[model samples]
Target chain A: MGPLIPNEIITGQWDFVIALLIGGAFGFVLEASGFSSSRNIAGVFYGYNFVVLRVFFTGMIVAMVGLLYFSYMGWINIDLVFVLPTYLNSMLLGGFIMGLGFVIGGFCPGTSYTAAAIGKIDGMVFAGSTLIGIFLFAEFFPLFEGFYYANNLGNITIGEMFGLSNEVIAFAFVVIAIVAFYVTWLIEKRVRKNMTEYKFE
Target chain B: MNTNSSAKRKPNYLNPYFGGVLLGLLLLTTFFIAGRGLSASGAVKLSVVTVVNKIAPEHAANNSYYSKFIPEDGGSIMFNWLIFGAIGTFFGGMFSGVVYGRMGKLRIEHSPKISKRTRIIAAAVGGLLFGIGSQFGRGCSSGAALSGTAAFSFGGLLVMALMFGIGYVFAYFFRKLWI
Candidate 1:
């Protein structure tokens, strides 16, 4: 009954409009959560701030639980949900690169945009660099084409790989998130006590 | 010193846990309506395709990577859903900025230990690497890592693990830039 466009429940030229509204909400949340600041975002690694961890893990757990519940009630069909396909080697390599970028740039694509909106020059530079980086990738696509399409694993889920139900995995995630939150809280308190340069805005 | 002084007057942001819940709810709604999760890097990819198509149509078409993005019927690449979503992200960010009194000024943000030039250069390099990596990984933090893992995707978990794992590994070296 849901996933309006894909299921023909809400067809027509309005799909893009719906996507925009959702994207807007996504952006608003990121900005309001202090993700607009590079220092705030980078603080996750330093333990001065753990906003990124809290929001990211919480959002993940909430969505995971929500989807499971929706399916249980038959409010939405889980079968129709899009699962990102896996390219094991490529994903691992790409993720490593993105991590380096995250630490170096201090902003991911989504956060950078919000930071730029709030007038952070580093955010602007990060966004500009994203565009340039993408351009560079496109220009040299041929060189990496073989690896880009390498190690196809299809659209498999963690549950499938682990031989567990989605509910079990979701439950584990919640537990892990809770533990992470508690531990990070302790760490942040200790780290903030020692740090003299950075201050919460 | 000016930056630190300005930061003092800024209002406190929402509690991280509270903000996380809000963000989680927003992500849940996205799946309920659109049947997918949120993304940011895909939009940048769309822009890249659009630009390449405009500058060198034949070259873009001939390239396997760019060709996948080009429409068979020949239309503007900017018409993509991700591109529109990115535009919406810009507006949404701006709207939040307006509400929070965070807009209307622009300046480079850097550690007192580092020069503005060093920070800018690092940002550009980081962005360039991230852009290329997203293509290989099939998504960045938002697409592959966050949304994918949320959906319980194996690939997503791998990306998330590697991304954060590598970040921690490299964070020490980049400590001067940030901490």
Candidate 2:
């Protein structure tokens, strides 16, 4: 019933307009939460800042619960929602590469763009290089085509794959996220106290 | 530092949980309306396709990956919703910066222990790596890790775990860049 665009309830022309508003809110929240700062982003790895983890996990669980609830209430059709397809091997390697990039660069693409918008030179550099990096991938696409498209799991959700209810999985994530929040909070307190350089605002 | 004002108050960020909730709600709204979550990197890939097609029509038309995005009917690839979304992200960030008073002259952010030039190089390298990785992974942190996980896809979960897990594993090796 929902997903106005797919159902033709919302005209095609309005799609881009909706995207802009959604992306704007996405960017606004991320920036206000200090995601525009690379140091704050990097804190998740060093234990001095768990803001990234908290925000990511919390946002995730909220979306998950919201989706399930919407579906249950018949406000939306869950199956119509897009689930990212899985190419197992490629994604694993990709994650590894990005993980290394995260530590060295201290900025992800989204945060980097936001930072660049605020005139952070490092953010600008990172954003530009990503374009180059993507260009390189396209240039060498043939070499990685087999592996890149291999092991496709085909938009499968965890519930469907594991025979668990979506509601159950969402509840588990909520619990895990809360536990992680508490543990990370303690870790941040201990870590920040020892760091003479911790930015106190 | 605000040169215009005499106030020395440090930049105050929104509460993390509150920020996360806001982001979560926005993400939910996106899915409700568009039936797809937000993405930062997918838009870049689209732009890359458009540029390559324009600069070297033959090359983009020949490539397996780039060709997939090239329209057979000669439609413009730049009109995709994701591109608009990316532009919105830029303006939104600018708006937030203006509100928070964090907008400043171009400056390289880095650890005090590192040189500005070194930080620049690091950022360049990182961006390049992330760029390539996002392609392989089908999305970056925002699309794959965040939205993917929310949808409860195995690959999304796997990528999310590995990305964060691997970051911790490699943190010490690159501590100088951050701490």
Candidate 3:
């Protein structure tokens, strides 16, 4: 009954429109949540703001549980859903590089896009740099092509790898997120005292 | 340059928990319809491909990275789902900014301790790193961390962990730019 595109319940013509609406909602959520600010995003690291951590983990667990439930209810075919493939070494390398970027740049790709849309010059610069970076990668892709394609662990999920049922893992993440939310709140309180530049409204 | 999120007539940002739930539901809906989660870097990657193809047709044709996305069926490489998603994201963000009154002016966001030039350099360097990393990481925070973890992908989880974990580790060195 779902995954309308692949199942052909919703024809190919509607693909672009649906993508637009979904992306719009995604952007709207990020922007309204204070993700348009570099400082706001960086707060997770400094402990002045835990908005990023809270929003990120909450969204993760919610989607996890929702997907599990939808699959349980037979509302969607789990197999048809796209699972991000794991390219171990390459991904690890990638994540490492991106981590540096996040702290230095203060916003990631999605957040940066929202930031740019909201008239953030830094966000705009960051977005433009990504284009240049990609161009650099494409041009020099041959140098690392061997390494990039080296570790291809096809379409595997955490629950499958750990031998835990989806529900159990989903519940674990929910617990973790709850604990994190509480702890971060406490941390933010202590940290904000020293931060004269930022105060929660 | 002053964000001053103080008590103003402007609309305040929504609660984090609510925003999370909305984002999650949106991701779920996206998967429910397109069988994929949201992403931003993919669009940028394709955009690069399009530009390279236009500027240096022979070079793009020969390059492995650019050639992969050129479309054997003979059309613009930009005719992909994520590109439309990126377009929607721009307008959606703009709409929210206008509604919240957060978009009247353009400025560089940084900590008071850091100079504008310092902030700009940091942002450019950081963005440059992300661009290259996304190519390797397969996506950025939204693409890999948030969307990846939600889908429970192993590599996605790894990327998420490493991205945040590393941020925590190296944050102290770059404290001035943000803090």
Interface RMSD of each: 1.2, 1.1, 1.5
What TM-scores do the predictions have? 0.96, 0.96, 0.96
Put down candidate 1 lDDT per residue, B21-135, tens digits, no spaces.
Answer: 8887887777777888888989999888888888998999898888999999987778767877777887788788889877777888787788999989988888888888888
- Give the alpha carbon lDDT tens digit for every residue of B76-99 in model 3: 788889899998888888888988
Number of clashing residue pairs in every model? 0, 0, 0
Docking class of 3: medium
User: Considering DockQ, where higher is better, how would the candidates rank from best to worst?
Assistant: 2, 3, 1
DockQ of predicted candidate 1: 0.72
Each model's Cα RMSD: 2.7, 2.8, 2.5
Off by over 4 Å in 3: A199-201, B1-11
Candidate 2 stretches with Cα past 4 Å from truth are B1-10
Write the residue-wise lDDT of candidate 2 on A1-201 in tens digits.
887788778986888888888888888898899999898999999999999998999899999999898998999998888888999899999999999898889899999889999999999999999999999999999998999989998998878788998888899999999999999999988998787554633
Question: TM-score of chain B, per candidate?
Answer: 0.92, 0.93, 0.93
lDDT of 3 at B122: 88
Report lDDT (Cα) of residue A125, candidate 1: 86
Candidate number that wins on DockQ, 1 or 2: 2
How much is A1 displaced in model 2, in angstroms? 1.8
Candidate 3 chain B has its poorest 10 consecutive residues by lDDT at: B1-10
Best by DockQ: 2
